[model samples]
Target chain A: MTGTASRPTLEAVAARAGVSRATASRVVNGGDGVREPLVERVRRAVEELGYVPNQAARSLVTRRHDAVAVVIAEPETRVFADPFFALQLRGISKELTAHDSQLVLLLTEGRDDHVRVGRYLAGGHVDGALVFSLHLDDPLPGLIHGAGVPTVFGGRPGWGDGPRDAVPTVYVDCDNRGGARDAVRHLVGLGRTRIAHITGPLDQTSAADRLDGFRDVMVDVDPALIAEGDFTPAGGERAMRELLERRPDVDAVFAANDLSAAGALRVLRERGRRVPDDVAVIGFDDMLPVAEQTDPPLTTVRQDIEEIGRLMARLLLRRLDRAADEGPVGAPSSVVLPTTLVRRASA
Target chain B: MTGTASRPTLEAVAARAGVSRATASRVVNGGDGVREPLVERVRRAVEELGYVPNQAARSLVTRRHDAVAVVIAEPETRVFADPFFALQLRGISKELTAHDSQLVLLLTEGRDDHVRVGRYLAGGHVDGALVFSLHLDDPLPGLIHGAGVPTVFGGRPGWGDGPRDAVPTVYVDCDNRGGARDAVRHLVGLGRTRIAHITGPLDQTSAADRLDGFRDVMVDVDPALIAEGDFTPAGGERAMRELLERRPDVDAVFAANDLSAAGALRVLRERGRRVPDDVAVIGFDDMLPVAEQTDPPLTTVRQDIEEIGRLMARLLLRRLDRAADEGPVGAPSSVVLPTTLVRRASA
Candidate 1:
């Protein structure tokens, strides 16, 4: 049962208002140049008939959809298995709602979905896009660039070689490097010299930046102390086990995220090690439920993930608004919010 | 720079392919009635010029955008702050991706957002919608129904008083009643008659159905043993505290969800009650991360949340496909998936 078939049309509205078709059309399209009396009559008719102007028809004239597409390229289910992306989405949703814009979510699982996302963007549906391209080797950046849609990235996107390889684009990122450094620094301050690092998947820029931050603090630390994790609790358990086998004397660990840290803690407990006595622990991304609920509450670095999402939307919306006012909008500057270390019992 | 302004038009493609504009247009719009040689030439010319047929123009002819909107209306931060919604989304995303449909996310925080979402759905941007309205008093159902979009609800929707008040609709849900019965039966087998129940917000049909299931097992149970929880660990903690005060002899607790169970477990520990030895605990939803990570793992009822999401999309997609073929489609049937009892340390 399609109610749209019975929806009143422009002709019906004009008939009900006792106005010319041209007058009704003009009033419906923002009442520009139309007098108050005719506009009022048309508005009353629209209200009575409950005639919603089809956006498809409106976009044909204005060439704008008043909607933004949010493309999230998370191939691994690990990312969605946690609350990280959910919090970011909440923030983005709130900001978009405030701007009176709709959010069209385009989630890509892998390479095939990437092409689907690319085609959708190129289809000229939404006003702009907000993309989260975490992995270094991801082709999404190049595809979105080629689509030529105005887009703002969620994290600091990594391209060819170095950070400078990042194309000049508007993005919002937390101080991942700074946060990681603080976590390690706090561990070191607690007299933990044999500090081991469990990194997230290095393909992601956040994980890479976090590892870099760890290395910056532990400059002369043993290479055997470092191991890779895929930003999952299980991965953290495996990496932590490997680090313990390689360097049994390791007294402290800095995990890339709270989930990984929880895993590491579990491993340490099973091995009959006393937290803060035998081993000190620190984690990044002070995820509250995970951090506070741990056996021995975790001391970690805090990054306002929701804030990062809100800022990303704000940046993209500003660009869209500026573009609407005139041609040749300047490239908006990227933002990196500061991170602070949250002290707890573990470290 | 506007890529669309410089985008190659049908006239340019026709010129390059040595054909008329009408011929090029026909080829681009699925090449029906056009000869193979001309279609091939036009396609090559279009590819070489990187021409993307405007969807805004195309939708006018097809009257379909091939996009689906997913409206998640949860005002509280607790829902989005956990992995529950994330798993459902992953399931929804995978299903929608398989069908080659885009997901437009509409998250509403308050009453204002409900109106905004109502208007957006009425605007007819997407072909159909998958809505999650967890609360009974929520006006979203009425609004979405008024919008007249083909929709499939996430759970068994609760209208005013009777089940008959529910508008005839397609929906997907887990067997909450069966799952709860299994949980209570397990506790009864353990010889725990004074079992307390921590329920999720009763305004939701899932919570109400779960309570009904609990009553199904314990006919002579005390009414004071049941306490309302909002499906958060914090809510669980509060409910557990209230239950302990009312009936300190309570030998078992059945939390409506894992997060609430985790909270109840924490309260039990704080009150010096050893799990299983003093008070056994069982939770619903069996969320892996929370259940396994708890001090002693939680025995609970398992619902395939992702499958619920997948089925919801399948039901809506089938309706949309059928609607395209002809006359008034029949009332689509709702689905209720089976749940299993996942045994763990707590019970």
Candidate 2:
């Protein structure tokens, strides 16, 4: 073994082992090549010389930073306030940590920021990219793919035209339609025919799917009672107020998210509507703390955000590993995790 | 100016400017040195060559990654559920983006993970670190300091002791005590003599400080009415139930946070108590959605979470720059932002 006097360089190891610098580097980096006896001799020489490969130098040779960038297409304020983003981030971080890769998080607020993000991703700054909360017609997918990097999306793009090109992408999504259907079914089971719907932003896939599910369920009952909310509490409150003004006899409401549901509940109370007595309510995406805190609680759809995040990370890693040697990597796959209805007093 | 067709190399620029490779590199990287006329010539050559120095090569020479790691010391599930964490992360991301530096996100689950984090920080993987949600007596601060890397904590460590070392840290905290006092005073003004307090985890600085403020305010009124919760909805529900069982005459409660306050409201509703008219309720941390969701709404203390996060990032950035200039950096510093009382329907 080498003494503590001075550490030897890769050149010293190569000279001692009577090998070329390239051969020594390949052996040191665990790259394929060279015979067993020569490899053994190089290994011994490396141990004796105590040569530790510089990380920066190794990174240059490998062209792999072992880092993935997570791009959030929203304002910083909205991204932080939303529990879904945080939970998914946590899951991504945990899974990435296990794989010994790094996570680079970026938030794009405006068009200029989007351009900067496009340039950064295309500039070989990270090995792969994960885009979250994408809108329907967002040009990011095209831009990121044009950069010639592997990409994965958190949720299915609202456009839902399927993967456009040979650009590999894995979509991790919750069962939005199934969950919304279950929520509406529960309302129907309660014998509430005049059920009003408070929908999220129509441009979002989750919102559209949830609204469609609600309508599908309502066609069997009545489709005349529907309104829209932007998934914000204030928006829900306004929607609830509008529905009440339009149809004062509405007996139930299905909100696309817990925040909107909670808002609807608040407005209902102000109008002297008793939860589950005068008007039953159910929400989608059972967010923590707030869901539990809702007076009379809330019957909602539960999406496993952490699990979704973990799955997204795994899919990205698989794509990065070039596992699909027979074909292309990550062949535009879609993964829809199951969601269940959480029953509470509200419904 | 260099045309698109005639992009010059560093070698070409050096030859044209009649300077050495080292001199040209130093000039291009904005490093100190070189005579004025030669520097001007090199600049002209650079403009003429359109030679954009590669990031990898520049990072190797400068040993600066221009990246900061935001370490969240919570499990993935909790990280997503807590709006406070989300807001803080968003704020940090925004500031880092504006600075044109990348943000790396890391979460440590256990003791072993902490060691890995230490190596990651010490190996010059990042320029500095911003840590959040530190539990009382957590050894992470010491671990970070021992690694010889700079760290900025989100809050005062609340371990009842001072920082282990004089490591330069920047903290952005809310005026928890002042906000709590104002909340309790509002209850008192509403002619509620028997006011009970539901506090957050006593080990947290905000919890302890808010409780202290409540006690200080109650000294002029009565000190016998106090209860503690773990800053969770369930904890708040249990605490509220216990308070009611012990003292049914209690007419007012000041919870440490909006979630806990919402929990208390639920329990009160179950117990057939009317909010505001029967028992006025107040909560800290206005947490917009939660506050608006409560029955009769909720009067709360508003601490701008987004602003807090932004301020924390700015402060940490300053500390990072300072630490880089100096040697191992200095000890923990604190910055407290103001809080406002928001009146709603509850109290």
Candidate 3:
């Protein structure tokens, strides 16, 4: 049955409160310039009648929906299986809840969804957006920019070529380069003589930055020590296998992420090598499930994935607030939060 | 600056198309009773003008929003850290996408959030809601019910004492009891006489049913062989520790879920017990990351988690469709999907 048709009306509330319709309307709209006694009476009447304000009616006047779209442009299963994105969502959800804003999730499988999403954003269903454009080739940033919604991105938007659009993007990301350097430095401090590196799908900026950080630490090291991975356990397993074959004397490995590092750990265990004795392993993104549950537990780079989500919301909210108050929104400065190395049994 | 104010209006499209305002209105609002040629002309003008229909205004007339709210009642970190919820969301997203509906996520932290969500559902912001209330005392189910929104619950709801509400709820849940029985039967077939059982949080129906399933197979089993687990890795580790201490010679263990199974495996390894040799182990849910990544993998019950989410959306969509077409919508049937035993190395 349609409850919408049976909901209590504003007239009923005014009648029950024994106030004029205009006074009741003013109190209900937000009690602006209305007496406290009338506001309380109307509020009590609303509660008793179970009257819910029609959002559609209010939104027409306010041009604000108190909702934000969160666009995740990854078709990968990692978006569902991995803890990385989930933590970020938790953070985003918390921030939005604080601001009394709803989170409209738009999960795009591919290009067609991008067009649909672009149209939806341009449709003005929500106030603004929080986008996660994970890959360099992901066209979401450009599409969203064209849609002209006030947006804060989860990570820095980088195209394969030069800047795709002239618009400045505001984003919050962890310091992948700095985090990778800390991981390698820790391994080096432990006196690992033959250190190897596992690279993620180099297309992603985070993975690319991490590889660069590894290169920064191991200048002039044998190229044979570097193995390519795709930020997956199977990829990590294959890369670890390849690295062992290429450099059998390798004493340590810095994996691109925890999932890959978990796979490397499995390989090390299967190969009859004692961790931290025969081979020390460190990973990026200290995802608790993988990091704490690993056999020897993982020593990995700690990036506050949730904080990135929270900061992204905070920045977007500020942009929305400023724009609501005055004119054009000034380009908010982007931020890269620092990372720390978490020591565990592996190293 | 605000693009909402600068957006192309319906009047602009009408003027640009060289048509009457009524003709353009017909074309923009689903092209009902409009000529094909005029509809084509109006569509072109709309595209050229980059016009987007204002959702608030449209909703005021149509009383229909092609949007669905996904309310996850768990304030626990599991909603974020566990792959269970994520997989469900992915399934819900896919189905909703196919139906041209937006997925609005509402993650509640506690009691106050329950009140907020109840109000939001009553506000008629979304067409319907897919709710996940993990615990019996969650209060979300009762609140959402009173809110009078069209709802389909993620799992079968059971109050601690008697039926909490008069409304017959429609839900989508896997055969948890059957799955548990299958797991126990498999362990029994393995010739493990002294089998231990680990239960999830008993307050929930799924966990309670699982414990009953274990009993359906292991009648008259020693009380010491059964241990309580909270469906977490730490809880699993603790339960296994207690079980091993009470019955060291327990030849097999059946955990409530893969998380606890992984935790149990950790304790078994640390205590120098070889898997499948010293103590054969089985878990439920067959969650890929936990099941496949664990040492020796895990033989467990496989429930179609994504299908549950997809089916929930299907049921709600069907309900919405019926309500739109008819006067009073009939109650849609609740569904219980089948589960199968996934054999892996642990058992």
Q: TM-score for chain A of every candidate model? A: 0.87, 0.82, 0.89
Query: Candidate 2 or 3, higher TM-score?
Result: 3
Model 2 DockQ, alpha carbons vs. true complex: 0.09
Query: Each model: TM-score of chain B?
Result: 0.87, 0.79, 0.88
Worst 10 residues of 1 chain B by lDDT: B159-168
RMSD per model, one decimal: 6.6, 11.3, 6.9
TM-score of chain A of 1: 0.87
Task: Please provide, for model 2 over A1-347, each residue's C-alpha lDDT reduced to its tens digit, 9 standing for 90 to 100.
Answer: 00112335778889999999999988977789789988988977755544555544445676666677888877666766667787788788888878877666765445445544654555455678888888766556655654555777888776464545434346899989888999999999999879999999887888999988987888864444778788789999999999999899999999999999999999999989999999999998888878989998999999998888888888888776763243343344669999999998999
Pairs of residues clashing in candidate 1: none
True contacts kept of each: 0.23, 0.10, 0.14
lDDT (C-alpha) at residue B321 in model 2: 69
Best by DockQ: 1
lDDT of 2 by residue, B15-131 (tens): 989999889988976788799999999977765443555544556676566777787766555665667777777777788888766666655445445544644554456667788
- Candidate 2, pairs of clashing residues: A87-B80, B166-B330, B166-B331, B167-B330, B167-B331, B168-B330, B168-B331
lDDT of each: 0.80, 0.75, 0.81
Candidate 3 residue B54 Cα shift, in angstroms, is: 5.5
Per residue, candidate 1 scores C-alpha lDDT tens digits across B1-347 of 23433555678889999999999999877659888999989977866565656765667787677788888778535445666777787788888888878766666556555645655777667778888745776666655665667888898888522233233667889999999999999999999989999999998899999999999998978988999998889999999999999999999999999999999999999999999989999999978788899989999899998888888889888888878777446647899899999999999
> Regarding lDDT, does 1 or 2 come out ahead?
1
